[model samples]
Target: MFVAAIVGLLVSMLFALVRAFLGPTIYDTILSVNVFGTKTVLLIAVFGFLMGRPDFLDIALVYALINFVGVVAVARLAQSLLRDKVAMLIACVCDSQWDC
Candidate 1:
């Protein structure tokens, strides 16, 4: 049963990877990456149990934290860039009307 579950998780991870690569929007790609990260954590936990090494769960937890922080950072960066672009466009549009 564990083997089957592991295989299923692996398959889902593969699909997530594919979506991450082919997603049309930034949010879609980010969401796929997050899914992939979560699947990885699950895989690590299950594989650790299969190997009789409980420490692997700790490692998985750390990896999960890293993944969460990374995704947040990427999202914030993307949002800031988008906000800046919108601000610049507004400024440009208003400048032409002497609105400062």
Candidate 2:
């Protein structure tokens, strides 16, 4: 059972990687990377159980936290860049107009 789960997780991780590489938009790629990180955590947990090493769970938890923080940071950066571009566009439009 554990081996099967491990294999399934590996397969899912591969699919996520493919999506990450070929996603149409930045958001899609981000989502796929997040999914891949999640699957990695799951794989670590399952592998730990199969090997009877509970310490691996702690490593998995840490990895999960890092993954979450990384995703949030990237999302915020993307949003900030997008907002800046929009603001710049609006400023350009306002500057071109005669009236405020």
Candidate 3:
């Protein structure tokens, strides 16, 4: 059963990677990458259990936390960039009209 779960995770991870590579939008790609990270954490936990090493769970937990943080940071950065671009466009329009 554990082996089967591992295999399923691997397949899902592959699909996520494909989506990340082929996604039309930046958000879709970021989501796919986040899914990949989540699957990796799950895989590590399962492997640790199968190997009778409880210590692996601790590492997996730490990795999961870091992955979550990284994903959130990327999302925030993307949002900031989008806002900046919008502001720049608005500024361009205003400047053309001699408004500033």
Candidate 4:
């Protein structure tokens, strides 16, 4: 059963990887990557449990937290950059229409 769980996780990870690569938008790819990261954490935890190392679960928890925080940070950074680009485009349009 544990082996089956690991295999399922690996298969899901593969699917996530495919989605990330084929995503139509940056956000979709980022989401897929986040899902892949989560599966990786689960895989680690399961493997640790199979090996009888509870300490590895602690590592997995840390990895999961880092992955979540990293994804949020990247998403926020992308949003800000996109916003800045849109703001610049608006400014350019305004400048062309008026003396601002």
TM-score of each: 0.82, 0.84, 0.85, 0.83
- The CA lDDT of each predicted structure is 0.92, 0.94, 0.93, 0.91
Residue 59 error, candidate 1, Å: 1.0
lDDT of candidate 1 at residue 20, scale 0 to 100: 92
Q: How well does candidate 2 score on lDDT at residue 30?
A: 87
Q: Estimate the lDDT of model 2.
A: 0.94
Looking at model 4, residue 78 earns an lDDT score of: 94
Off by over 4 Å in 2: 91-100
Q: Which residue runs does candidate 3 get wrong by more than 4 Å?
A: 92-100
Error of 3 at 20 (Å): 1.2
Clashes of each: 0, 0, 0, 0
TM-score of 2: 0.84
How do these models rank on lDDT, best leading? 2, 3, 1, 4
lDDT of 2 by residue, 47-75 (tens): 99999998999989999999989999998
Candidate 1, 34-84: lDDT as tens digits: 999999999999999888898999989998999989998988988998999
